[model samples]
Target: MGVIPFLLTYDIIIKFIEKSSIGINYLLIMSGGIILSLFLKGYLYFQGLNASHEAAFDTLMGMRIKFVEKMRKAPLGEINAKGVGSYKKNLIDDIDSVETLLAHMIPEGIPFVIVPILIYTMIFVTDWRLGLLSLGSIPFGFIPMMFMMKNGTKKMPMYYKSAEDMNNTIIEYINGMEVIKIFGRTTDSYKRYKDSVEGYRDFTLDWFRESWTYMAMYTAVLPCTILLLLPVELNVYLNGTLELSKFIFSLMLSMSAGVPLTRMLDFAPTVIQLTYKIDQLEKTFEGVQLKEGNESIAIKKHTIEFKNVTFAYEEEDVIKDVSFKLRQNTLTAIVGESGSGKSTLAKLLVHFWDIQKGEITLDGKNINKFSVTDLMNEISYVSQDNFLFNTSIMENIKIGNPKATEEEIKEAAKLAQCHDFIVEMEEGYNTIVGDSGDKLSGGQKQRITIARAILKNSPIIIMDEATAFTDPENEDKIQAALSKLIVGKTVLVIAHRLSTIVDADNIIVMDNGELIAQGTHKELLEKNHKYKTLWESHMKSMDWGIQVEEEEYA
Candidate 1:
């Protein structure tokens, strides 16, 4: 296709120079060749582009799936430490950037690069001197591009860091919008968001500013193959050393090489960006992961034991040498002040993080011996976050048990005390929960998550401040429902409100990460100073409202 146009031009020039009649058949044949080349070029390009896109999409899907699988195997603490924004950028933006490399660079760029090389070869065959001149401009063109690439490489780290930082800040700003508004910190939050955005913009502009000069030089010089070729070729023709036909053919071919060469050069930055994106993805893929075993042993009991378990998010252990036993079908409560490792202990049992030392076992088998799926199937965890998907309330509940019937879902929702309010909503079970259940109140979302857990009906249940958001009236109702739901189940409750877990079969009092006392609530209150003090605090807090009302009336 590229050679045909140049051939046609050269033939016409020769016919004119010869001062002879141009044969109609010769013209027809050349014109037909030109048209056929164009049709084939378009057809092949379309087919190649479609194939590349299909391949790119498949690769993208596979990459994302693998990334998700890696994250699933990774420790929850590691994932949380990186922040949602970082993963979002890696998963969506960074991975998506590869499409340009796979789809455009591989399919279109190869042809562009090959066509230029082929044209240069043809020119070399015609006249070695013209080919040599055509090659002269390439070195000069590449010098600036080399400088541009060097500048891009030097600045790539800063550019990517800023992009990731901006993503993190934007996500934080959006997610914390409610808190910002409630606390009247809108200006501060907005300033941080604006600063991150500006930081990214500044780094991007600085990089482009540094590269643009080199870019202009290359963009101007690369396509001007005639810059050297035309002058030298014209001189040769004028000196009668080169025939007009050969001269015309070489010059036109040199000119035709420009487009493909320029197109090929355009992918240079994309290649660099692709390398950086892959590096970022590899960081996640190589992150620390929770180990799992291939064992599928059936457990006769749901008893969980954490024996001399030590763990940490970083250097210092948050759960230091913690040992406890949770017998099957018993309700155990973990209570402590903030950062006392109450929730951490429960999370350890859930295998959110692997223990640094000792063992966590189910039915006397090491928890690590059980596959993640097998371990998760035996326990239902309702975290403090009460995270719900942006879907129908019914669908969110059904996530606990995908095959759950509608009646079972409704029954679970009723048990969680969410059924009445769900029915009152316009769409009832079909209502979209909105992003992270923003459509529902804090308590409503909590109830929905509890409903999910209830539907799961796993032998083991971990409730980390599950009812923290429920009002006093609803708390009692939810507690009653929970009491029924926990029958013959190993239930572990982490609570701030002492009154809620008063009836727990065993209460584990923690102070600073150590389990200081473990007994029935009454026995712990009687024997442990920490438990007595915690009970005192709870009693005082519970009386504050009544005291305030009496003082107001007086």
Candidate 2:
């Protein structure tokens, strides 16, 4: 399309110079050729762009799915350590940035690069001297581009780090808004959020400031092919060494080459930024993952055993040489101070992370031998931090067993002591839970999660402070439901309220990272000093609460 115009112009100039009358048929043919070339160019460009966008969207979906699968396989501790903001950036922002590379650069940039070379080839064939002169401004343009790329590469890490920091700060600020307001720390928290945003803004501006001069220089110089070609080509034509027609053709071809060359250079910054984004994604895709197996073996019993298991999040061991057996159809309770690794034990049982030493087995088979899905299918874990998706109450409960009927869901909710309250709501079972079940109270959310667990009816149930938020009146109801739920199942309960687990078949007492004692609650109270002390303290706190109530009544 570009060459056709230059060829037609050469023909017209020659005809005019010769003082010959141009025929109507010749003019019509040239006009038709120009129109045909333009239509073809536009049609091809549209098709290429359409194909590229489809490919780009497909690639985006595949990448996001792969990322989610990787997250599922990776250790939960590692995922949490990366923070919600980092994952948000990687999953949404960073991955979305690849669209430009796939949808624009690959399809359009290739043609832009190729067409310029072809245009230059035509000019060189016309007159080699003129072609050489046409490339004179290229070296100057390239000098600035090289500097820009080098500077961008050097600053890319810092820029990405600031962006991640800002994302994290913003998310943290929003999530902690309740705590901030409650504690009257809103001003301080806002300052930190403000500082993070300002830091990102300042760093971005500084980076742009450093590159703007080079950007201006290259963008101005790269397309000005006439800078050298016009003067030198004219002199050569005057000297009669170059034909007038060839001189004009060469000049037109050189000018045409500039459009494609400039278009190619326009993606240079995106290419650099894309490299950094891909590297960030690769770090996660290539990170260490929990080992899993493909076997699906039948278990005669749901007995879980941890044999001298030692594990660490980073360096310091959190669970040290801990060995315990949870027999089938028994309620086992783990009791400890805040950092005594009680919650960690429950997490390990579900294979949230592989232990560094020893083995965790289900019915004498190592847990790792079962596929992740199979392993998860056998256990129902309910933690103090109950998380529900932003969906209808029915859907949230249905997650435990997607095949469950509406009647089964309501039954489970009744067993969880949540049915009455749920049905009282305007939307009944279909009530939207809002974000993370924020529309419900802490106790209500906990009951909903319990309902989910009950609906699952897995062979093994692990409840870590599951009843921590329930009021005294509802606590008894939930305990009764829990008794029914745990019947004929393996249960592990982590309790801060010592009275709740007094009837547990076996109670494991932990201090620091080691299992200090394990026995029935009665045996532990008599034989273990730690257990006796914890019980005494719990009793004293209960009495203190009663005494305060009595005084208020007086």
Candidate 3:
């Protein structure tokens, strides 16, 4: 279908002397060729574009969802290693690079490679002289750019890292702009951001300049190919080495070879960068992802056991050979100074970090087998650094249970001691929180997070200093509400404030990542160790004149 029309048009057009005095037979064949070629090429072009678009869209969306799911399921140790700035860079800039490759660069380059081989092959059969010259031009056009493209690929990772640094600097500057102004420290740090922007600009423009300069030379090189073949073509014509029709076909073929060849060089940097970006995204996606299914966490029973569990972050052990157990429905408190691994212990029970050499079990089954999605369905966590999305107050509370009824949300808010203040707002439940709930005070934000947990009403509750920022009245109210919330669930409390968990059924004291003491509040005081010192400090900080007397062991 293609060959007959190409030859017919080539011969017919070459023979037609004047556009004014059109050859009827030649005109019909030429019109048919134009129509047929246009339709075929247009169809192929649209098909290729659509395929690339679909593929790029899937990879882009998949990377986003995969990274989010990985973060939710990965060990906190692994997840935290990838900081906010790096992850942000991957999501925004890195993904954009991949999209360019998938969409424009790759799809377009396919034609660059395919059409050249084909057009050159046809010219070779007609006249070998023009064919050899055309083949030689391919290497000349591509070889010089090969080293630069290789270097560009090597530079890509650092370029992305540098770009991310600029991104982070800008984000940091904006986030700290108010503080910088208040402290009058803007000049020093903001200048650094200005420099980073310039650096990125210079790097980018240099890359473009190098690519375009070489590319223009490569394109300009193609016309010289015609001149190189000129002598050979003339000799062939004079000695009956090439016929008039063959000469015409060779001319068209040489002209056609130039385009896809120059394009391959012009597109080289994009292709290289795209390949690199996709590889990076794949690395990001290769981590674990949380899944929802029947086989989630182990079934809850009347008791929970921690059998000599040990855990580490990188090389440093955060929790060491820790062993403890709690009867069902009891509040187990882990109390320690900051950095003593209290929070790490809380995370272990929730299966955030699987034990290295020990076992955590409910009903004598290892918890690691269960999916995080399943475990989260039964566990509610309120950390000291509570995070809330920018949304209506009602919706933030509803995060605990997306389908929670309005009444249920309000009741949860009431239980968390936030209902009164929420009602005072002009929009009440409809009030919109700014990013990370920044519009609210620490106490209010904590209460909102608490309300979210309450709305969840999971069977296992983990409170990691949940009241660290609540005011006195709100603290008392939240404590009272938490008392009710913990009634039937297994509760784990991680606190730096000893008083908060003074009434806990069990208090395990940690120091230097080791469990140094364990017992009820009364028992730990007589032990006269870290727990006693912590308790005494808590009492003194309150300015209490005397310690409350307890029943004597004597």
Candidate 4:
């Protein structure tokens, strides 16, 4: 309607110039209506965008919450296998991409597409021939889009894979920067990081170079609805089959149709990105299906029995036909050479990965029959890689028992031999540990984790080389802490240092994933050949140290 009045205003001006029209009322009214329409259009567009953003953010919040919940329920082994970089990307970057789909594509693209169809229909109703001519170029436009889709389909998977690889490399580079610097491996460390970045760059460039031709073709053809229609309309008017006013209106309407079509075409890449991201999110959700127990069993005792347990990580068995029993209120130490499955045994008892052949029983009941929550509550696990959060020292220790009082936290810290260091700090327990406890020394961090375990005070405590990083001076303190924490509790300790577990109630020797012998340290030293050799080696290594002498300098 506005187009007709505006076009007619042009004709009316010509008539007034010829002295065939005297008043300018029609021109003034048409100008006012166009101005009013422009204001209304701006208002509606902003309103729509605002509403879409609100919906998009709400949807994003829900998705993030569900994703976190899914991760919590998933097995730790499954999560580790997927890698932290992949998980972070899906949780943060992939979910952010969905916001683009909901906020812009669904709300704005709909109007951009639907309004054009309606506008073209109006043009066609006014003159059927012009309408047909206007849409004649769309088939050619689709030819380019089809090629783009084909090329995009082939490259998108590779694109996302390269991106994930780069993300992983970046995380590793940052986290291991200190190690790289200390080992003088700056070149090698940066090489891997550089390779991943270059790989992603090359992939992106190759994809764009291959698809640019098809993209240009579509861009050129999709928004030119008047290209073929204009000449045909002019020919019809010359033949006296169409009036000038109808011809002008048809031309304007064709241009309007092209505007929306062009806007709709711009959304094609967003659609592809959204579809691929959705697939990635679904894959993440499907990756970890944790096998949960039906009920939480009542555990009366802390004895653990592994009955002919056979287990594998990647088709190769790490623990083969392993049978062992740990009695309640006893300390059992597992000592073995490297790659001898010492840590694996401790992990199995904690149900980190289920065994392939037999069940592990706790208090004569299959551990699998107990709920994961109950199982975790019954055991306290401390490993060599003791992770500490970036928070106050007091808060980090309190994570073991969230309901623990401040006094209890201090007591646990004191028992772990970390109270002296904690109090020496400027803020004492309130000092932030920085990222992953980087602000603290290795021994300090280890002691804090021990404090956490002490605070947990579970009936069963499994220690996998928990004191491996501590200096000889702090070893005594840590041992004292362990003695207090494990009183009357079933303890399974994986030890690399033979001297630390020499007095263990029962020392189990492992070789090649098989338990070779089980006895006290003295009995093993006399009866087991492997145990004697390992002990000799450990003693020699402990005694070996560098000495600086003035005689040598002279």
Report the C-alpha lDDT of model 4 over 63-126, residue by residue, as the tens digit: 9999987886676777887788898899999999998888997667998877778867887898
- Give all candidate RMSDs, comma-separated: 2.2, 2.1, 6.2, 3.5
lDDT of 4: 0.85
Model 1: lowest-lDDT 10 consecutive positions: 545-554
lDDT of 3 by residue, 470-531 (tens): 88877988999999999988899988778888899999988888888899999999984888
**Model 2 TM-score, 2 decimals:** 0.96
TM-score per candidate? 0.95, 0.96, 0.89, 0.89
| Residue-by-residue lDDT tens digits, candidate 2, 1-554 | 65667667677778888789889998898788878887887898888899999999999999999999999999998998998999999999999999999999766899888887888888888778888998988998889999999999999999999999999999999999999989999889999999999999999999999899998998899999888999988998898888888887777777777878788888888998999999999999999788889878898899999999999989999899999999999999999988999999999998999999999999999998988899999999999989999999999999999999999999999999999999999999999999989999999999999999999999999999999888988889999998988989999999999999999999999999999999998999889999999999998887774334445553
Task: Highest lDDT: give the candidate number.
Answer: 2
- lDDT-superior candidate, 1 or 4: 1
- Measured by TM-score, how close is model 4 to the native structure? 0.89
Q: lDDT per residue, candidate 1, 407-470, as tens digits?
A: 9999999999999999999999999999989889999999999999999999999999998899
lDDT of 2 at 98: 96
| Distance from true location, Cα of 510 in model 3, Å | 1.2
Better of 2 and 4 by TM-score: 2
Ranking by TM-score: 2, 1, 3, 4
Clashing pairs in 2: none
